[model samples]
Target: MNYEAFYQKSIEKPQEFWREEATMIDWDKPFEQVLDYSSAPRTRWFTGGTTNLCHNAVDRWLPTQAKTPALIAISTETDSERTYSFEQLHSEVNQVAAMLLSLGVKRGDRVLIYMPMVAEAVFVMLACARIGAVHVVVFGGFAASSLATRIDDATPALIVSTDAGSRGKKVVNYKQLLDEAIGLSEHEVPQVLLLSRGLVSTAIVDGRDVDYDTLRQAHLGAHVPVTWLEANDTSYILYTSGTTGKPKGIQRDVGGYAVALAASMKYIFSGKPGEVFFSTSDIGWVVGHSYIVYGPLLAGMATVLYEGLPTQPDPGVWWRIVEQYEVSLMFSAPTAIRVLKKYPLENMQKYDTSSLRTLFLAGEPLDKGTSEWISNALGVSVIDNYWQTETGWPILGVATGANGKKVPAGSSGVAVYGYQVSIVDDATGAECAANEKGMIMIEGPLPPGCFQTIFRSDQRFIDSYWKQHGDRWLYSSSDWGIRDSDNNYYVLGRSDDVINTAGHRLGTREIEECIAGHEAVSEVAVVGVVDPLKGQIPIAFVVPRSLEHVADDAGRAALRDALSKQVDNRVGSFARPSAIHFVEMLPKTRSGKLLRRSIQAMCEGREAGDISTLENPEALQKIDTIISANHG
Candidate 1:
């Protein structure tokens, strides 16, 4: 296949080009048109086409290169490694699928998958696909109550999980959580498929559940092999990160997902056959579904899955994995970078990371501080890629840098082909000038891989994204960014995180950077707390290098004054934090981004649900104390 020719044609006539690309895979039936944009935000792709993702990702590859390495699992602990060839993966998935069939799972039935980064998790996902079951993957760290809510909501026929999964040296007991979560559910409970990694002696079995090993043995000779399905069917139901209310399940089709994913693999990762592409994000996140699973697998490249935090037993764990796997492409989050930076540089020097080539960052706004450090310390060029769960792949990325073009440190590079990117004022809905901050909206008929609708709430999806600026353009992102005269885009923080005081608009990230510039401050989180005087006032939660100084009122005042001065010099007086809470730590998500909402909730003395994802949940309690002492 001439991928380059297809990409070039896709840029010219996307609809027609995509129709052609859709034919590359085996389809149960053909479609009339590649796309129909009759509806604004909820356009359908491959209008009448039918194909299956499992056929392309696993089944097709099984016949040609079954002996080739398909997956590389790197544990967070030092020197934990496992590799599965296409044949091994095929056999595992086949056995799992047979077990699922024995348990009465049928085509189109939903399956809820909740597990850590273990290789069995991937095998389970593949098994679901093999048998035409729609799978929903929940992150392993989610609170049991939250996990149970999703399971009850989706009402899947089967739930697959492990007794325990290791993260660094810490063990997550998913079985206990699973039991507690489903204890109160009145809905029909799904049959449990359990994997006991190190808990063989402690295995708990029930009439409604089957042990993973036993299930595999029962299907040893019952392997029916993976078969192809139609493309237009539901591939999987991925629940979005629900910060608002209940997480909305986003249903994606097989054909569109496969086509859009192939483009992303080619253009975004510059992936070629047999290349090793590693992403640090867990399968729970959307990036993991696209880049880590479907995309690389469809491109005929090897995908590496890291099962633990970047800093487990040591800070150099990820670097060592890259050297050991010979990973050519690496993708991770900015939060991981910050955690690693806290470790001694000497620890990182012990590993050889020369195999890494292109480095990509996503999930949150990448600060220049981390970007520079990655480029200088790792000796790999860093590229910032932008996309949402709904956008499918890299709608905007630094594509030219695939050849080593040095883009300015902070820019997300120019818009990739097939996207019309612009920054516009929220109130007026007009494009903003160069260097002016505003909402970033992509003008498009909804592309393939974009979500069809927010599972049960069509109006919510429309109200959240489409209805913002008339009904013509789809507004999928809440982030703010600016384009320079050179047409390079620099992402600011989220629009909701933008602080407005005394007629001046300031980004929380800007204030954060200024506070971080101070020698005494270790880390900072800026939030617009409710105030009677100003509509909302910016507050700083600081993590000081030395608690001895920060614990005192005088020292706290001095540091606050210094941070105020720095903010004024860097951005302006309006951007300066009105109050600074010198605390032991700041609340953050597991992925490592500071949680402004958690801080806001704590400051307001409200509940912060599911702190299970936090690397340090206890940090929030300390923050609450500091907030109360200051406000009281």
Candidate 2:
């Protein structure tokens, strides 16, 4: 079906539409009510159905496709590899589930997973799903303090982690961090199951700590029945950083999540049974939960789990994986693509990446320059889709297959079926005309896969999202966007990130995109700084392709002037940055979102609020030094 037809049917008769879509999954008990929106923010989907996500993902395919490769695990740190078939995956998940059950982890209990990107991590997640336990998978890189905060909020019954994890050349003592986090929090975690990766020494606690291998051995022939749960039952709780200091746990439901992800895999990624799909995201992130583990597995496709960075070992590592595995579809973030862009395209040319059919990107805005460069370099269909941790799958994208349209470069395609997206004026809450910029909102009753509620804060969920549009119940995405005359949406930066200078509101993305077009520039982040005359002036922090060119004052000045001219020629002088500072790196989250707020705070000599989410917190110091040397 074409975009308009599918979207029209979905919005017009959402109940009927979702009912038909729900048939894709193997539900233990069919849903009677497709939607129950009698309650506003506390919306319920497939209220009466009972199903187990793990069954649909693994067990249903066991009889016929038992030997089909289910997961391909690639280790970036050691260049090691392993593959598991559907039967093998099912058996492992059953074993793990039996072990969890033996440890008193019953249905509805929360289990915290703080492990590296390993095959065992995937198994742990599936095992939790199989037994109807809510899995809170924390990113491994987070410090003990951050983990403590989550542990306190989640109050999980058990914790699962590896002794250590290797990221590139650095070895992370995950168990040590977990131990410290447990010590910091008042919540008593009764049990800890540690998986030894054979990389680092681990100190096991006397009464609580248990080796994962020991549990597996004891539970060898045990079988744990999949816990069929009501559709509205919580499946997972993923913590995302909030505007306030504390993180908000976004809870997702089982039945709706399964149906939504299965539909997205079929529609958005155009995945098919036996196809090899790869998404280079750590299991800690939502994309990994949807695409890497559950989505592809539910769609009966092989999912590649890469345990290293794209540029690890060499810049050509990503291309090598695609060629080696005959991967059909690949999804990654814009930052990863930009990092790859810094390396010569010749490295990609060495691999025969003919099998790669579609490339999808999200997690951050895909700048036009990076999109164009990767499209040309890969010689495949490259598309940028938009979604969040709350929205389980792609809310916007040019889906693959006959129904999909040609992707307009840099535009996150039209809204996916079941999502009615609108660009609305912030003040009036009225829809903006095409080409006019405004806040991006999703008119709800949001479809099944969307987050049901903030775990413990229903009021916060309402206040943060639902309250913004008043009684209209629009889910405020907190993003600025514009729809072109052609009906394609261009997501501007966050509404707060919009630069208002001399009565003109400019998106940082527009300026950054223009600056990125310059040959010397590798990456760029533009922030609006306070200015007495212009209200706020745009200042850019740029990472040049080569540091040698900007090693001296004269070189820096020449390069700045050149970039300024490029911006002026591309996006007008009014949009040009007042000053450009060359930096070695840009501060970003682990998921690849540039922390513009942190940069703005550093520039203004204020506290960069809650920087625990940063991938490299040290980058903030370099940013401060650059701002001081340039502006002071």
Runs with alpha carbons beyond 4 Å of true place in candidate 1 = 1-12, 20-30, 77-79, 200-205, 225-227, 400-406, 468-471, 517-522, 544-562, 582-584, 609-612
Scored against the true structure, residue 54 in model 1 reaches a CA lDDT of 67
Candidate closest to the true structure, highest TM-score: 2
Model 2 gets an lDDT of 0.89
What is the C-alpha local distance difference test score of candidate 1?
A: 0.76
Q: What Cα-based lDDT does every candidate model obtain?
A: 0.76, 0.89
* CA displacement after TM-score superposition, residue 493 of candidate 1 (Å): 2.1
> Taking the tens digit of each residue's C-alpha lDDT, what string does model 1 give over 167-216?
55777788888877778555577588888777423436467677888878
Clashes of 2: 0
